[model samples]
Target chain A: MVEQGGGASGAGCMGCPLRQRSEWCVLNEEETRFLSRHLKKRRYRAGETIFSAGEPSHGVYCVASGTAAIRKGNAEGNTVLLRLAYPGDTLGYRGLLLGENRRYGAEALGPSKVCFVDRAVVKLLLERNPALGQQFLRRIARDMDEAHDHLVRNATLSNRDKFIHLLRALMNRHGRTATDGGHFMELPLSRRDLASMIGARHETLSRIIGRLEEDGIARFSGRTVYVARSHWLLNDSRPPTLLD
Target chain B: MVEQGGGASGAGCMGCPLRQRSEWCVLNEEETRFLSRHLKKRRYRAGETIFSAGEPSHGVYCVASGTAAIRKGNAEGNTVLLRLAYPGDTLGYRGLLLGENRRYGAEALGPSKVCFVDRAVVKLLLERNPALGQQFLRRIARDMDEAHDHLVRNATLSNRDKFIHLLRALMNRHGRTATDGGHFMELPLSRRDLASMIGARHETLSRIIGRLEEDGIARFSGRTVYVARSHWLLNDSRPPTLLD
Candidate 1:
């Protein structure tokens, strides 16, 4: 929660890698200059909460380094991981835009540095650039679509199918090419975290992973999972063609 | 699926009740007049599909009358009910705003009349009024928040809690006050649809409802349901307090 402003010249917004690659950082020269003036860089330790649910929406955070977990809780006080956000990803725009309390909480998965841009500054930028506003709108819309897809999957898919889909999604989101002509993903969390993300019990997750391994779909050792054959998984990930 | 643009004058935007009540219709007189010029109204029969997933996003639809079900198919090719769109509610804005294909399919719950506004015209209106753009942004943000809440509920809440919470939500959204100090809800769909919504099998849903009746929490008869009390349901609906 500590804010470190006026450090853009040091290790902050100046020449940040996310500016060149992140979709949310698609800002023009003037916009970038404005960000350099207002963005505050905050550092967080692993597992430290960046923001909690019901907190006022004062600003947004762009993860400059390390990863973050976005989580929500139910009526029974159990928290579920909604999504894992990676470096260069933006967070908290929903609360800022909606003028509501935060619906989910975010925590640093590891030592991370995130740049916080004030809500007023962000609104001013949107007013000056409608395209920027549209970009953010598109991002939020995509989030809603993903949530809907998750709901459908949870309600209808078998546990095995859900497990494979989760791996495929993780591969697509944060995979690296393995030397053995396969995909490898290094998740920031452990099996328990993955189990929570896919809404499966730990023993059930283990049983399914064993089954998938037997079926030659994917293999996991430690936090790094290797996918030897992705064709079936990829095919399974294809949403049923809507009867248009 | 049928296009009848010029027939708008007979059943369209002119004198539409939604224009007065919908937050999406928070436009100046000038924008309202513009809507009158370009919006087309269409009628759909019960059980008829309004739009399917993967359809190109050309415009947005506002439910003028009747109700519609928004659904998405799971990996098993079975469709799940996502939510219901009622009069004064807008649909398809997610795809339209994101410039992506429609993620969910919509169909008439009963006979529904919905008005369509062209994407080009909507964009023009947004450019003309930034406040209107903010309103839409806020609406989309709220939608994302609700989606996150749903994800958490599905993952963390027990089956009984989930069922009760869904009823409370439906009652809050579309219930009518009964004469006997209870709440009455006339769901456009049947028990099967309700079963799909709560992700419960028909037999399990029946058992839960019977249990609730024994507890004197609620009662369902045909298409109408009556809740003898709401305070307990409302109290149960509050999300768990997040551990900051």
Candidate 2:
């Protein structure tokens, strides 16, 4: 991995684990060489708002390292977390397609490095190089698929299923270790944040977590939570049409 | 409106109100002349599936002169209706961008005349005729706005809210009659179809409709549903997350 450069115009970061691992960050040597010239690396501390929902958007963000959550705020001051973006995930393109300032706020979970590529650079790379664009497009589609799944959960899944799904999603996105007798995922969200992330009231969230812990499906300490068994949670309850 | 002079296409139903006033099909004499070469029209009877969810999506579609319903199906042979599309509305581009089959299905509610444009021709037009492409892109963004709002409802709103939103959306899209008593809009869906459209079971749909009529928001006669009190149903339930 090249470590001598640390700015937007640097033609390095090639063969770095971060670069090689992410499906969204699958740039080859030449492609990495091309992008590093256009990508400026920026850092954000925990709880820092990277971008607001209505700010003018220019570049697409790729998480080089660290964690961030995308959320939307309502008039009642209620906040809903959209997703926790991790290394290799691209932030803000879905909003960019809608126009002008985005309609969601993104905030860093902890110390995080993000690479910003100007939208023009992204368009050029997508149009000029079909293969690279294909990779990016595939990633976008996957993001969209996840978003649609979220839609279904919000519509159909029970609260318990929502909680389980939320954990499963985070584990899928950023689980760093399959520890002995259990798994450990390095996620960056507090209980309140998790409630917002899954669209549950804080009290409701607490009950669900307590229920899970009592049943040994989960355990939590600090910001980390563990599941002793996951698959069994499927039968706790299924999603319901509450209005009915 | 010029009677097409030399070339001829999409002229089977000339007196249709939707065709006459379609925002997307407002081609003047010369513009119609320019577009005639690229237009192809197809007709389908009532209850016909125009396209399925997983078929190769070739190009964008517009209702030249008919009503169509956008729907989706799950593994249980259950269908979910997304929206009822009419003249001036474009479908399939979202799938086209994803380079996959459409996420929803479209079926004819009546004998319908639909228009088609070649994807290659659309690409050429976007490339060689930038203004047209920009106009089309704006239209695409607007369509996506509707989709996004629907997604927000799917995410945040309850099932009753979802039904109210769906009714209001129909009025906005295909509204026709408004008397002093209550506004009248053509009901384009069967009760089962309405259930699918709002992701509810049929009995649940019956109960909601029964209640909506009881609440004086809407009344249904045959296939036509008259919705007069739309302000609250349309504006009140919108989640603040969307405003963000």
Candidate 3:
């Protein structure tokens, strides 16, 4: 279930932390004011559904805080965690732009807040501001690049290596560097979600975690993962391409 | 190796069949004229590299004919076929938009032709044509949606089911309706490429193909696959979502 938060005012948008992001930063003062007038804030608790698969997309959601899991469910009743949406990330725009029903469901992994802009409002804004449309294009292109990377890693990486890569990716996104030269972060996803994200079985992930613990590579306590030697996670990781 | 073909003249864009597609069709006459003036055509022999991973993307390629495989190579030297590009599909735009080196390489699956639009030219066109930018956004969004679908299938479908889905998808894209009520399509990919596309070993894929032949569902002839009962391929496939 979701709780409707107070509507964001034009002033709110002007001061929004997300405004610093390239996608939002490009919006002019007038455009920001127009968007804020239609923006609705929704708060979801942990495990609450933000949207469901097959639902008609009415608008786009931009995560205001916390993380959400984008999941796809199959006929076998299994769910695959396609990716995670963090603060400043937008969702549902793909369906809106393509005029298709939602192909996947999104759920809040923890207490989170998101801002919604109706489809019609987005269209109107894009028509008035071409810069906004181009920014969206760039954002989607970046997403496509990441999706390709994920597809390749899924097909080629060993289960252990995938886990390490996932950890490193998450760390890069949210980890706090420690004086001990390690990194610490609270995992937003549950164990099952993590397994789904890496396309591994729950039991298999548990076994891998146990091995990591034995090797002092990482420690899991509650919802937190502490990397003892972050560099170790890079071992066996795909080498950077020459261009990189 | 790449071979330069005749440069497309402005008049060519006016009559190009691809212009009928939504992405290109959105281009106004003036925009088409501008694009044609800058578009260069290139031809590739079967198995020739169009672009390699880590290369700087100078521009985008729009397939004119035949197919190309988008592939990713790992440190272990194993390659994963991410997807196939058919006629009217655009490539390399992701890296161009993100200002990153190409994350994956693309190879011609057969003798093929592609039209190239330089980065500077595209940017100028987009700056002059807001509709063109919006159309590109829609195109990228559709691609992202498909990538999500592929990821979900990879995570949830069994190997046999995945193969069936892949066959059905290809058939939908390129198959010819047959008098026998079955669809016949030449497989653009080699057996090795097919195995990589489905994230399976060549031996495993061969075994599965043998089983399909024994079951009388699909027949393999050289590089072609004939579905004796097309509907049978839908068995065990993911049910269409309520929205679909």
Candidate 4:
């Protein structure tokens, strides 16, 4: 049942949400029709395994709805949530593009819909339209640039500061909210998941969140967190000493 | 000085390195002839600033010889040396590609040679052969991939481990040599410069290097660092901890 696919391919391209600005979304209708015929839509339930690290391969999948998480673990079983992918993003594609069989595991964060495009299909598309391939290349390039910059910042900054900064970044990307305290934007992660994303233990993340609340930097009610002062979190004014 | 460029633009259908791989490198023989007609090489002394971050646009410089240290700094003046660029690598092309007037500074780590291709010329090349544009896109993609991975590793690892892992990575990429009690790699960077490259303070870097030596991890003499046990350094052997 695991390897049973929907069909030979060609399903999710036309009327796809990603068709708006994604590389697959061609400027011309003729190109779009050509590509649509090569895409296929697939669905998965929440908590379903999309792909495992070190597994064979299924080519790349373009997300249409819901969310997915990329997670990697060390030999000791310590896990790190690499990224929380959303709509319009491509998942498990980096490996195919890089020509690697596998590197990490990907799972649906919730009931998600994805479009599967096989390697052969991709090659055919490239052969048919190099310009579209060029657009795909650019999209990956942008993702790479942002990912690298984010890593440097994470490595250099302290746990709490990084947590706050990540919150700020996600807030900007998703949506911003103006609250009486300052700006409170909801995070799309569990406490443990947030901890793993920032390379801290679950307890450490909880402690830091508690400390932030006590310091009036942020507040939390159940799973929801409210930022009391966004400016203080964003600016390094009188920065706190960081000891690792 | 910003707009001062050739009235003619550079296009890809001419003789460009990108022509070798795909249409992206489409450099026709005639355009190649014209470049040879006007091409000139420039040299710089070691420690020279070729172009500082925020400098106005001019043209892209392709590394012709020696080496160039690429770096990006934060608002706090802390820098992250992106990479040590060498011959055959293009230096400072991102701004030109992104349409940004300026960002990121380029400096020479040693006596370096470079060929400056006018921005106008590149713009021309892009127009004639969109395929050739793919080559430039590929380069950016590679850079982004490297930077992104580096950031991810740095964010997840501790400072001491990050430095050790960084040296291992460097040794692999640049090659290393074995000595009596340890291994030595041609140290491409001074302590301050390396600290900048690895995103650490100079003092912390110095202390960490000393600690690494004391724990049979490595020995530093002037610019050369001979890691006592290179294999262990490469591995995450948490049992072998360095005493403070």
Which model scores highest in lDDT? 3
The 10 consecutive residues of candidate 1 chain B with the worst lDDT sum are B235-244
- RMSD, every candidate, angstroms: 5.4, 6.5, 5.1, 5.9
TM-score of each: 0.86, 0.75, 0.87, 0.79
Pairs in clash, predicted candidate 2: A53-A102, A157-A239, A158-A239, B81-B196, B183-B228, B187-B224
TM-score of chain A for candidate 1?
A: 0.85
Query: Over the stretch B76-146, how does candidate 1's per-residue lDDT look in tens digits?
Result: 67878888988988899988887878888999988888878889988898778777777777777777777
Better of 1 and 4 by DockQ: 1
Q: What lDDT does each candidate get?
A: 0.76, 0.64, 0.80, 0.65
Segments in model 1 whose C-alpha atoms lie over 4 Å from true places: A1-14, A23-25, A173-175, A203-221, A230-244, B1-15, B213-217, B230-244
* Residue pair clashes in candidate 1: none
- Per-residue lDDT of B59-137 in model 3, one digit per residue for the tens? 9988878899899987678999988998888898888888889989998989998888889988888778767777788
Colliding residue pairs in candidate 3: none
The better-scoring model by TM-score among 1 and 4 is 1
| Sort by lDDT, top down from the best | 3, 1, 4, 2
CA lDDT of B136 in candidate 1? 78
Clashes of each: 0, 6, 0, 19
Using lDDT as the measure, name the better of candidate 2 and candidate 4.
Answer: 4
List the candidate numbers ranked by DockQ, top first. Answer: 1, 3, 4, 2
Q: Enumerate the candidates' DockQ scores in order.
A: 0.66, 0.24, 0.64, 0.29
TM-score of the A chain in candidate 2: the value is 0.80
Model 4, A65-132: lDDT tens digits are: 78888877655566677787788787765666556666668888788877677788776776677676
- Model 1 B-chain TM: 0.85
